[model samples]
Target: MKVFLTSLFLACFLLIIAPPLMAVVDLYEFDTESQRQRYHALIEVLRCPKCQNQNLAGSDSPVAEDLRRELHQMLLEGKTDREIKTFMVDRYGEFVLYKPRFQKSTVVLWGLPLVLLVLGLGIVAYIVRGRQSTNTRKMSLDELSSSEQDQLKSLLKTSSEETETPP
Candidate 1:
């Protein structure tokens, strides 16, 4: 019983401490402060293909680590940000970028929201104008011309008389 308890306590302790020990932190030395800033910025804006939703800087997946290493190496090589982005796009396709460039292929992705919004506003405006016209055309008894008032009285009298008669 004592041995079982000891083993259980030891397993609990190891479970508690193992996760922190397993997390890997990258420490790359840059030649200049600008290179370091650029490296950090690029990682922040780039998505991890394996993780889908997490950016490179936030993901701990092996693919994210490899991409971070590749980005650091590219910075050391003095590649422009555009060139690095181009290389990544070429190798991984455009899904690796957090903000894809505007191109013919992406026109619908960018323009659809604006088109939908304008269409929605147009429909709303049409509905509102139609309602406004209907409201304005409705004549109150006080607003009706004398001849019109006489006609309305006759119609109401006939309607009431018809309702009072059988069938």
Candidate 2:
């Protein structure tokens, strides 16, 4: 009875401590190298619809697996890359492709940020230069009017007299 309990405890401990093992999918099942390559390529370029951060090949989610099988079947049926992609787009929309199509709608999506960055840099440069030029135009106390300069000279004279030692 002690041995049975010890064995059960060991089994539970191992189960809790073990790292998750990933199962290998058989790519060899495809008859031709081209079919295998096409399958891999299609899966690599496709974003996992369920996990937006992962490619279909890297994600083990059911949606990714299903898409992989569909891609394999499409390759077996001799579908062109364009056809397979079109089919995926029709079923899943443009979000499935990692690189979006270069359509009018997506042009701003690709180009707007870069344009904004350039415009922002130009504005910053203009503001910085304006400030620098204003600082470079330094004004001296000697360049003031007679009345304003007299007041400054009187202030300096009073401050100097207060700091002087008696002779």
Candidate 3:
């Protein structure tokens, strides 16, 4: 019974700790601190083609691993950041870039948010103006003409008389 309890405790501890230990960690050596920093930054901003929205730094897919290796190789070859990005774009297309450049091809991607925001603001303003006009019309006692006021008074009197009588 003592041995079984000890084994159970050990198994529970391993289960709790194993996930962190099993996490994918890339260990690439860089010639300089700048290179290491640049590599880390590039990986963070580059998306994994296989994982859709996941960045290379966070993705554990085989494609991400392969991309990491390719990036490391490029860095070792002393490729400029722009050159590295261009190469990746050429090979994997713009989808691999987390933030694509503003070009004719990507104008919609960059401009869509601003256009939608302006459209939304215009719609809200129109709705607010409509509501304000309606509220003003409803709330203003002086807006009622003499004839309308007289008709309103007669209606109120009739309603009051009807309400005062038992059904």
What is the lDDT of every predicted structure here? Answer: 0.95, 0.87, 0.94
Candidate 2 to truth, TM: 0.69
Residue-level lDDT of model 1, residues 77-153, one tens digit each, is 99999999999999899999988899999999899999999999999999999999999999789998999999999
- Please, what is the TM-score per model? 0.79, 0.69, 0.78
For model 1, what is the error of residue 68's alpha carbon versus the real structure, in angstroms, after optimal superposition? 0.6
| Candidate 2, superposed: residue stretches over 4 Å from native | 1-6, 14-19, 22-28, 31-35, 140-167
Q: Output the better candidate (1/2) by lDDT.
A: 1
Best by lDDT: 1
Clashing pairs in 2: none
For candidate 3, lDDT tens digit of each residue in 74-165?
Answer: 99999999999999999999999989999999999999999999999999999999999898777454778989989988999999999999
Cα lDDT of candidate 2 equals 0.87
Candidate 3 wrongly placed segments (more than 4 Å)? 8-24, 135-148
The local distance difference test score of model 1 is 0.95
**Tens digits of lDDT, candidate 2, 42-72:** 8899888889679988998899888888888
lDDT value for model 3? 0.94
Clashes of 2: 0
